[model samples]
Target chain A: MRDTYQEQLDELASGLADMCDDVARAMARATTALLEADLQLAEQVISEDIKIDDVRAAAEHRAFGLLALQAPVATDLRVVVAAIHGAGDIERMGDLALHVAQAARRRHPQTVLPDEVKSYFAEMGRVGVELAEKAGRVIRTRDLDAANELEADDDAVDDIHQHMFTVLMDRNWTHGVSAAVDVALLARFYERYADHAVAVARRIVYVVTGQMPGPLAV
Target chain B: MRDTYQEQLDELASGLADMCDDVARAMARATTALLEADLQLAEQVISEDIKIDDVRAAAEHRAFGLLALQAPVATDLRVVVAAIHGAGDIERMGDLALHVAQAARRRHPQTVLPDEVKSYFAEMGRVGVELAEKAGRVIRTRDLDAANELEADDDAVDDIHQHMFTVLMDRNWTHGVSAAVDVALLARFYERYADHAVAVARRIVYVVTGQMPGPLAV
Candidate 1:
């Protein structure tokens, strides 16, 4: 019974790692949809978000079952609780990616990113995917160093977010108010996607080290 | 020992109720600060947010202790787990309010909302505070009717959010890109604040009914 319980716990962790990969793919495709005005890709991302949510529900259900049946104590208890928390954050990351995809679909037949700011989003998308992948690795390996790297990558995403705002507010910007709003919101989606990835990594750190680094920068 | 465990569980619920009140007050003050350009009030909201976080930490610690020492199962276990999840959502509500306060401070003495949009924000603020208070009531009483009402109030917030966007995107919108960006972000903060409040209420319903509310509308 104890060995089977251990496997359940292991499965929960790997399940979350897989979720991180799912959201990474969703974000990468959403970015492509936004850049290329590919309505087909955007629709695919929007429809497929359910798979991520299903994975989250399964992870949470498994964690709940473990807690109820095994009543794990000490480190094991923390692992289960952290799994619940990590699943929520990862699910939210998928939702953010879905929002990005929806934005792409909303502007179908007309690309969302103005040329001047497209490169910033491209970089944000690349870094955001990298952060999600690193988060997956961190969950699977419990490597504290790898977990720490997510923070730096998140910072890079924030920098690009700010730079995008600069381009939007620049005197040369010709995009009207509607387009500016779209860009602002899209940038926000990428920034929050990275933040959630970092949040997942932080949960893993807490599970392993028994210390929750610090309160996330507001 | 059993009696003490019951009391600890009760305390966790009340702690979360108090947190709802704290965030409600913070959101109220944040709205005032934004509308009045009151730098002092904005700063108060910003600094006082730590108190909310502290309350959250205490609540989680108590819940964890219950799980570890009491090893509660069935309904008792759900209560403790729901407390953990509810505490997280409430803490995020405080953060969203803090973001509103920060937006207010960023444009101190120069109101964030222009003349035409002031009334819309005023309505959003009123509805947002009402939702938080109702959420607190639902937490303390487990009143499913009140919990259901939160969904309606959240809809009102969403409506105002859409209205604000309409104003921003109107052909006559004279606010330049910077101000438009500020309004867009501020609207998002209020909308998200209301959403988190509703999330807390939904957790209460789940604890009572044993069914999670249909996944939050996106």
Candidate 2:
């Protein structure tokens, strides 16, 4: 039974890690859709939101299943709880992307992306995907160093986020309300993406060290 | 040791429950301050927000302490998790009130609540206080029916909130942007208050059933 429980926990982690990967990809794709004014991509993301929700519900059910059936103890309990939390964070990130996509759709088709800010968004997208992959790697290896590294990557995302804000606040773009809303919503998406990724890293830290790493860890 | 653990859990729940009672009152007081434009009352609520924060932190710490010490299983674990979630929800309710109090202070030294929406704010305030009180009662008694009542209360609050949109959308007022900001911000506070109260009820359901409740239970 213990072996079966351990296997269940491992399988659940694997599923969650894959779901996180897809969540990250969806966010990146949504950003592309927004920037490129691709109506199809935005609509796709809106539809894909159900996938995120499905994964979130599945993660919780799997965790509770392990809890009720195996009465998992020790590391196994931590694994189940961490999976639940990670799934929740990932789902929130999906919601953030949905918000951004909606704002973009409301703006109609697409607005031209600012050059520096576009680069920043692209870099953010890359970092987000990287974090998702690293989260999966940490789960596979239970590697403290891998988890710690993912935590550190959050700083790079934040740095670019600050740059994005600076671009928005710069006196250069004094145009329309749509521009302001688009920029604000995009910033929210990036900030929340970084936040959710860091949360996964924090859960990994908790699993190993039994303490949540604070902002200082970043 | 097991008996002592149970004793501590009860004591912690009682103490934290008292803190929740305090938060519910502060939220009510803040709502009253908004409806009456009572600067003094608003100021009082603002000052008391620190006490609410103190209680929130202490409740979280106490729950975490119990979790770490007892390493409780099944029902006990659910109880602690619910308490932690309930504490955070109450804390957010306090935050929404503080936002209102800050607005009241800005309107300052004068009764600035628009006469047109005074009744609306009053009803909102009333519903918010009543719902919060019911949530507290449900927590204390672990009564599912009382907890279920919160969902109905939330619907009532939502109805008032939807009506607020019609008030804002009314072209008759011909108010400027500042009035629009005030109206929107006020609606947000009421909407958020109802949300947190519903969260408390949801936690009650989680505790009683050892499973997450459906949307109706909220």
Candidate 3:
């Protein structure tokens, strides 16, 4: 019985790691779709997001089920609670990626951005995909060092986000209203996608350290 | 002992209701500050948001304590878990309100928006504060009807959000890039503020109806 409980706990952790992988791949593909104007790839990312959600839902079900059936307490209980919340953070990251994919799909054959903004988004996509991959490793290993490193990566994303505004707010900006709106929303989706990654890392830190951290910047 | 547990649970519920009130008031003041360029009011809202955070933190601590000490199960267990998550949703709403206040402060004596965009934000503020109040009542009463009604109120916010884009995208739009960015971010703060209220209401619906609902639109 004890072995079964431990196995279930391990399964929950592995499930979250897998969800992180899905979200990372989705983000990378969504970025590629956006930059390359690949409608088929954009659609693929959108559809794959559903699988991410299903994985998250299954993880949460398992976490809650363990709580109910195993009646875990103390450390075990905290692990379950953290898994549930962390799964939510991961799920939200997946949704953010989906938003990126949808943004790409909305433009279809048309490019989503002017030349000036495209490069920033391309960089954001690269950084976001890299962070998602790191998040997967941190969750799987509970590496405190990696968890802390996630924030620095997030700062890089924030810098890109701020640079996006600098370009938009520049006196030379000639993109007009429609392009402006797209840039604003798309920048936000990527920034928020990175924020959720940091948030997931924070939750894992809490689970491992048993220190309830402040809420992630939303 | 059971009565004691019940009383603690009641206290948790009341704590969340009070947070709803704080968040609602902060949002109202933030809106006033934004429209009138009231730096003092904006500062007040920003400072008071700390109290809101304190309340939510306490509530989570108590709920976790109940879980550990009471060893609650079944419906009782669900209530505690829901309260923890619900408190988080409300706390995030508070953060959104704080973001609104911060935006107003960031602009200082100068208004954050051009005169053209002011009325739309004014309307969004009114709807947001009213929904926060309604959300309080829904959480306190667990009124499924009111909980469901919150979605309609959120639609009003969404409409305002869409209108913001329409204004931004209009050929006649005269607001420069800086003002446009402010409007975009402010509109989103209000829109997301309403989304969190709906998310909270959904949590209450789940607690009351014992049927897990779909995730709120992120």
Report the number of the highest-TM-score candidate: 1
User: Regarding DockQ, does 1 or 3 come out ahead?
Assistant: 1
Per-residue CA lDDT of model 2 for A63-127, tens digit only, reads 76676566665566667667766876777777777766675576565554555467777777778
User: Which 10-residue span in candidate 2 chain A carries the lowest summed lDDT?
Assistant: A175-184
Select the stronger candidate by lDDT from 1 and 2.
Answer: 1
Sort the predicted structures by DockQ, highest score first. Answer: 1, 3, 2
Question: Which scores greater on lDDT, model 2 or model 3?
Answer: 3
Residue B3 alpha-carbon offset, candidate 3, angstroms:
8.6
> Worst lDDT window (10 residues) for model 3 chain A?
A209-218
Superposition error at A155 for model 2 (Å): 4.9
Stretches off by above 4 angstroms in model 3 are A1-3, A213-215, B1-3
Candidate 1 accuracy as TM-score: 0.97
Q: Compared with the true structure, what per-residue lDDT tens digits does model 3 show for residues A1-218?
A: 35599999999988898888889999999998988889999999888877887887789778767877788877777778778777877888888888888888988888888987788999999989888888889888989899888899889999999888888878898877677778887898899889888878887888788885666666
Clashing pairs in 2: none
Score each candidate by Cα lDDT: 0.90, 0.72, 0.84
Candidate number that wins on lDDT, 1 or 3: 1
RMSD of each: 1.5, 5.4, 2.1
